[model samples]
Target: MPTLILIAGPNGAGKTTFASEILTTDLKGVRFINADEIARGLSPFDPASVAFKAGRILLRETAELIEAGTSFALESTISGRGHASTLRKAKAAGYRIVIHFLWLSSPQESIARVRSRVKKGGHFVPSEDIRRRYPRLLHNLVHHYLPLADLWFFWDAQGSPPVGLANSMTHAISDVDRFIHDR
Candidate 1:
């Protein structure tokens, strides 16, 4: 079956690292979709300037893949309603949806990691953006994305190295909710 695996969480939550691990396994045939990668390709010197264009291109590519029943994976923060409609379309097109969500205790963790990345010359996301998206992403993860997912994995990204809480939603839902509600 065609699949759409979403590596999602707030920015700097190790979504890309997890996605890279997925790629190294049996998903070699799946098309990889990272907006930052697309933006960089559009303008290496100033990727942020063309971010919107990259998003448009990603939307187009995803639509085409859905129409063709192709398997793919993408990165998202799940902060807004941006991906809800797309997942609906993918479901309609018979794509198996999987979400691997990386969780941090707070926005402060996200800010700290992004700052570390900036020191290493990585792309920068403003701390304000991370702050606003943090709670919003968790909210959407619980109310929107979780229901659509055929399979869901939650990873606690609070440690120096993140750890998986559970591999299946059925096994993890209560714990996941508790973790979220505790904050």
Candidate 2:
């Protein structure tokens, strides 16, 4: 059995940081896939072309890995229909799916974080862009994507996970362990 964890959020919501922590700590030996990494060579200021290519590559590689029974975690903004479709495909492929959504306390917080990241010479998505898109992202997660998750958790970037999510994650990890052992 294989598992696919999809971490979704707006820019600067700390999705990558949380995904990396899970990969290094609880989910050692699992593959980590991120479209941002694939598109690293391109300027984030011009996102469309780079994101298109990265999405294509990520889908192809994810399909192959799922077919080969590899457990993986995928981190992405996941704000569009393309990403939603990819998650559907992963579910159809029989991989256990876990979804995590991360957000900041306010759009101001997200804007500040994006600016800080850009100042640090990291990949840049304009603070204005992040601000403009944050509400839509949050809306989509709450209204559409949240229902699709087998096990889901939401986190606040300024603080900790929403209450009981830590416990849910513990249970999900136990389930993942059982899935691996049963296979």
TM-score of each: 0.94, 0.78
**lDDT (Cα, tens digit) per residue for candidate 1, span 56-153:** 99999999999999999999998987787889999998989998889988899999988987898788999999999988998898889878889998
lDDT of 2 by residue, 1-183 (tens): 578888887787778888888789999988888878878756455555588798788889888887787888888765565666666777788877788877565667777777888798766776677767776776666556655667787665665433223324455544433432343
RMSD of 1: 1.5
Which model scores highest in TM-score?
Answer: 1
Clashing pairs in 1: none
lDDT of the structure predicted as candidate 2 = 0.71
Cα-lDDT of candidate 1: 0.87
Model 1 misplacement above 4 A:
172-174
RMSD of each: 1.5, 7.9
